[model samples]
Target: MAKSKNFLLLISLLAFFPLCFSSKTIGGYLYPQFYDHSCPKAQEIVKSIVAKAVAKEARMAASLLRLHFHDCFVKGCDASVLLDGSGSIITEKISNPNRNSARGFEVLDEIKDALEKECPHTVSCADILTLAARHSTVLTGGPSWEVPLGRRDSRGASLSGSNNDIPAPNNTFETILTKFKRQGLNIVDLVALSGSHTIGNARCTSFRQRLYNQTGNGRPDYTIDQSFAAQLRRRCPRSGGDQNLFFLDFVSPTKFDNSYFKNLLAYKGLLNSDQVLLTKNQQAMELVKQYAENQELFFVQFAKSMIKMGNISPLTGSRGEIRKNCRKINS
Candidate 1:
């Protein structure tokens, strides 16, 4: 009788262990059903607002998704990127990577305003950003993943982290992979997440070096298809048009798919970072080719990588506050 009781107790403990630590497996103190009782309509509200925004402007999907990536890379998705500069807050928005580039703040504000009215200080801006990113992906015909919630907003922003952590368009393959690895992400995650470029736009300034004077030799990067480079040069120019918008994946600019990988296969990738996946590393090149040929494989890895990225050192439990307004911390 004692042995049977002990066995039953052990089984009960085993069953309860997963329920207790399942969230910990992905992210500390975060779970998909976090707002199930606190705010039953949290996900619904975010989805509806994001849908409306993307419908109004298709590019908004990528912008919103980029916001989450930028936020997570800096300060571990604490919504520091959303904070405005005021007093002690340096504001990640003004960092080198974000200035004149990062957008979709208004769309996040719209979601926050609706969420605030519905549940007061229930949802964190960090969580809002995560949900918006997932919705943006689905809206743009990309893979869908259940976002783990319960992240809280930080009272401070890291300007240096924003500028230094987020991978630059011109970063070498090793540098970019190093940055990703610093956040507990691997080469597979780096390649999969780079796929996000499939639906976004890059400014001419980002790839101008590749078009002219690559390696300071005053010659265009030969890796880029010469004819394609000429077409880019026509609009990108040598001196001006720094902000001229070009689809990252010209093949299906607004659609989220493996065309970005396919572009790299043909050396038509818009940014050096995108092209380096094929040119700079053997492992990354193999992954790019695989993704280009089997989009379903790309989609699966992208979703998993995104979830892993979102888990990077989140401020959870009681460590951070639930800001009444995403733009400012609670006074």
Candidate 2:
């Protein structure tokens, strides 16, 4: 009679929370419903904070989206990018690609604080990043997709991975492709992901080399439209103002769209890495043209590629800990 009562209780609980109890698994794969029961409001909390942050600063959406990319590239979206230097753990923030480029840490902290009040340590910081990126994209009129959860925070960071794995704005097309391949991504993924440039700003220092002495011949890169080059020069210059900001996509800087690929076609792409898709390789150029010509196609592939990128070597099944503070590993 006692066994029958216990079995009845279990069935009633499962009936009331069908998704919550069954979503989290022990294996490596993640699911969108991982936090359905564990923290039912996890996704909502992240999206609300991201939306509020983006509303305060239109560029916050892009910055938050880029944060996920940066985190994934180094140490597999384990929130390694969030860790500050402590003991043996060297922070990735000071690395080359992240030195002056990465932003949106404060916004993440705000989200983390809110989540802690609601669900405590049930949600992981890495999952918050992935969810924030998706919400940021949607807030900026980009495609929305289900972000798989279950990623845990890393106990240590990789400064070397940040420097070597994330491609620089001036890297050669072959080098950039090699970096993506290292992440198990292909050319299509690379081109689709680069479309993220459609919505952000780039520092003058990141692309100043293309405006002057691109090939060490003391001449500007001929591939860049001369008028655009002149505009960039007025702000970038040769010596000072290395930190001057330029819109990556001047047409719709805050909107997510195919104008970046179109800019590449017009030789007005802000980064050498952006323009090389057109000039350096046939396959890459074809992909760029397709995306530029078809916004729906680009959006579809971008959503798919984002899921692929987010799935790269995530920590699951007790591999890592849920960080209490994003910037510091648990003591």
On TM-score, the candidate that comes out on top is 1
- After TM-score superposition, the amount by which residue 230's alpha carbon in candidate 1 deviates from its true location, in angstroms, is 0.4
Q: What is the C-alpha lDDT profile of model 1 across 1-331, one tens digit per residue?
A: 5564354335434433443365453335777889999999999999999999999999999999999999999879789999999997889999999999999999999999999999999999999999999999988988776677789889999999998999999888899999999998999999999999999898999999988866566665778998899999999998999999999999999999999999999999999999999999999999999999998778777877888888788888778899998999899
Candidate 2: deviation at residue 299, Å? 0.4
Pairs of residues at least 3 apart in sequence or in different chains that clash in candidate 2 = none
What candidate 2 gets wrong by more than 4 Å, as runs, is 1-26, 217-219
Q: Candidate 2, residues 1-331: lDDT per residue as tens digits?
A: 5564354334423322432234444555677778999899999999988999999999999898888999999979899998888888888999999998789999999999999999888898999999999898889887776676788888989999999999889899999999999998999999999999999899999999888875677765888998999999999998899899999999999999899999999999999999999999999999999999998778777877887788777888888899988999888
How many steric overlaps are in each model, in order?
Answer: 0, 0
Pairs clashing in candidate 1?
none
